[model samples]
Target: MPANFTIVTLGVADLDRSARFYRDLGWEQRGDQAEGITWFRTSGSWVGLYGYDALAEDAATEPVPADELPTYRGVTLALNLASEAAVDLAFARVQEVGGTIVKPAARTDWGGYSGYFADPDGHLWEIAHNPYWTVVDGRVDIGAT
Candidate 1:
């Protein structure tokens, strides 16, 4: 199989609400109507928002109840910025959109600055500035700095 990472779809409780949250972050959806799902284009991948239980059904897996979903889902999506100031700005934008600040932006022991936040459905997003990596045009390239 080719090593191409193309899409990241998030299963959300209320599709419209999730769409709005992302849209508030300045992301434009593919279509005007979400019907039951929506898609937003990103620098390296496409982000999809679909119904929580419906997504599980499509994957032939049992769906976790919304109330029972754990705070940390064992996975996190990251937005790597070009500078420390950019990371700070991202955290501020997240808060402006009502995202829960899981970890306030601060200097990390790894010699970078980072912080975490949770969306309405408890999906964790890390906003970070990794000095070891190069971020050009909003995409991270390893070992290129």
Candidate 2:
């Protein structure tokens, strides 16, 4: 299998609210966005927003109430930064756009800096800066030293 991700579609409760949140984060929807689904292009992939119930139905699964979701979902999307200061700035931006800060940025036991925030639909986002990693053009990877 190829080690690449094409897109991540998040099921949101309120389409407009979720859309507005992303827009407030300096992202613009793609030019060919269609009705019912909103698409935004990131540095290396596309992000999609669709109605939560509808998305669940499409997958042939019953929708779970947002409030009932587990505190720690099995997956978390991350935004890696080049430095601790950058991570701090990104967290600040998230707060400015009404994202819920699960935890404030702090030094990690692994010698990195990180924090967590949740979107309106309670999607987890990690903003972090790993001194041992190389972050270039929105992509994060470890360089051979």
TM-score of each: 0.95, 0.92
lDDT of 2 by residue, 1-145 (tens): 9988989999998988999999998886874435888998888898999999989999999988877997578999888999999998888899999999998999999999999999998999999999999889878888766
Per-residue alpha-carbon lDDT of model 1 for 1-145, expressed as tens digits?
A: 9999998989999988898899999887896544787899989789999999999999999997999988888999999999999988888889999999999989999999999999989999999999999999888888633
**Runs in model 2 with CA error above 4 Å?**
31-34
For model 2, give the 10-residue run with minimal summed lDDT: 26-35
Clashes of each: 0, 0
- lDDT at 107, model 1: 95
Judged by whole-model lDDT over C-alpha atoms, candidate 1 comes out at 0.90
Clashing pairs in 1: none
On TM-score, the candidate that comes out on top is: 1
